[model samples]
Target: MSNTSEAIDNDTVIKEFIDLFAQQDATTLAPYLDQDIVFENYGSPVVKGRENVVSLWAEVFSTMERVEFTTLNQAVNGDIVIAEQIHGLALPGRPFAPIKNMAVYRMRDGRIVEWRDYTNSEYARTLM
Candidate 1:
C-alpha cells in the first residue's frame, strides 16, 4: 500500500533523526530539516524559523548537566511520525519542566518540519 510505505519511510526518518539528535550531529540533522523548521519547547516559548530551531538546540542543549533521549514507543501514520520519547536534563532545567518529558516529531518529505515538547512542571522543579 502506498500509504503504508509512506508511513514506514517517515518512521525510519524519525528513528534516524532521533539517533542523530542524540549524538548532537547538527551537520547530519541539517539536511533532514527544511530551511523553515518550527519547534516548540515545553514550558518555554516557541522557536520559529530554521536557524533558531537548530541553533537553539545547539546552544541550550549543550548546557545540560545530563540529558537523555530514549524512544519509548513510536507509530507512523502517513507523514506523521507519532512518537513518545523520554527526554531528561540535569543542568539548566526549566522550573516548569520535569527532568523527563515527552516529545513529538512530525516529519514531511523525509525531513522534520515541526516538533513539540511536553513535560510536567512539578517534576521538573524537583530537579531544579
Candidate 2:
C-alpha cells in the first residue's frame, strides 16, 4: 500500500471499530479481535478472549433498542489506536443516555488485542 493508502486503511479500521460497537455484530467482530483481547466499559467486567468478547456482546445486543456513535477523532500510530467519540443509547422506554468517551485499542497483526474505555461518571451512563 502507498503511504496515503495505508493511512486511509488505518482510518477505515478506526471507523469500522466504532461501527462494530454500534452494530454489536459478534460474528463479524470476532475475526478482528485477538485471543487475549481485553475489553472494558464503565460498569462491565474487563472482558477477555475473542470468544468471551463475542459472547458478551451477544448477550448485550439482545436487549438493545438502539445504539449509535459519533466519533470525534482517531489517533493511530504503529499498533496503537485511540478514538474519541460521543455516543447515545436508547433502551426501550428509557431516555437516551449521552456518553463521551475515548477508546484505546492496542492492535497487533492488524487486529485489536487490548482495549480500554475512559470516561467520567455521568458521561459514562450509556455503558450501563
Candidate 3:
C-alpha cells in the first residue's frame, strides 16, 4: 500500500498518467513513474525500473504515428486504480485501430509503482 497520508487522488493521477501516452513523450511521462516501477504489457516480459520502462515506451512511441486512450470506466481502491480503456493506435503507415484494454496501476507516494496491462493479443497482432 502507498503512503495513505499523502492525500493522493489516485483516480486523477491514473487519468493524467494515461493521458500522457497520447503525447508520446516518454521524457514528459517519466516523472509519474517511481524509480523502481514495474511494468508488464500483455504477453510481454515484465519490465522493471523506471529507466527501462521509459526506454521501452520511447521505442514504442517512435513507431507510433498517433496514440489515444479513452477510458470507458475507472475504479479506485486505496492505492490501486483500475481502468477499462480503448486505446486507439496508428503506426507510421497503418490506420488507427481501437484496441480494448484493461490496466491496473499501483500508486505509491503519488508515483506509479506498478502497472499491468491486459489486452487481446491476437486482435492486437492484426494491427501490427
Instruction: State each candidate's clash count.
Output: 3, 0, 0
Q: Which candidate number maximizes TM-score? A: 3
lDDT of each residue in 1-128, candidate 1, tens digit only: 99998888888877777776556545656777877778877778888777777777787557765555667888877877767776655575453233555666777777878888787776766766
- RMSD to the true structure for each prediction, in A, is 3.4, 2.8, 2.6
Deviation of model 3 at 18, angstroms: 1.2
Encode model 3's per-residue lDDT on 12-125: one tens digit a residue.
888888889899898977889999999999799999999999999999899999988899999887888889999999988889989999999988878999999999999987
- Cand. 3 TM to true fold: 0.91
The RMSD (Cα, Å) of candidate 3 is 2.6
lDDT of each: 0.71, 0.76, 0.88
List the candidate 1 regions with Cα displacement exceeding 4 Å. 92-98
Candidate 2's error at 118, in angstroms? 0.9
TM-score of 2: 0.81
lDDT of 1 at 61: 58
Q: How do the residues 9-36 of candidate 2 rate in per-residue lDDT, one tens digit apiece?
A: 6667768867876775668788788899
- TM for candidate 1 is 0.80
Off-target runs (Cα >4 Å) in candidate 2 are 1-8, 126-128
Judge candidate 3 at residue 125 and give its lDDT: 77
Best by lDDT: 3
Which residue pairs in model 3 clash with each other?
none
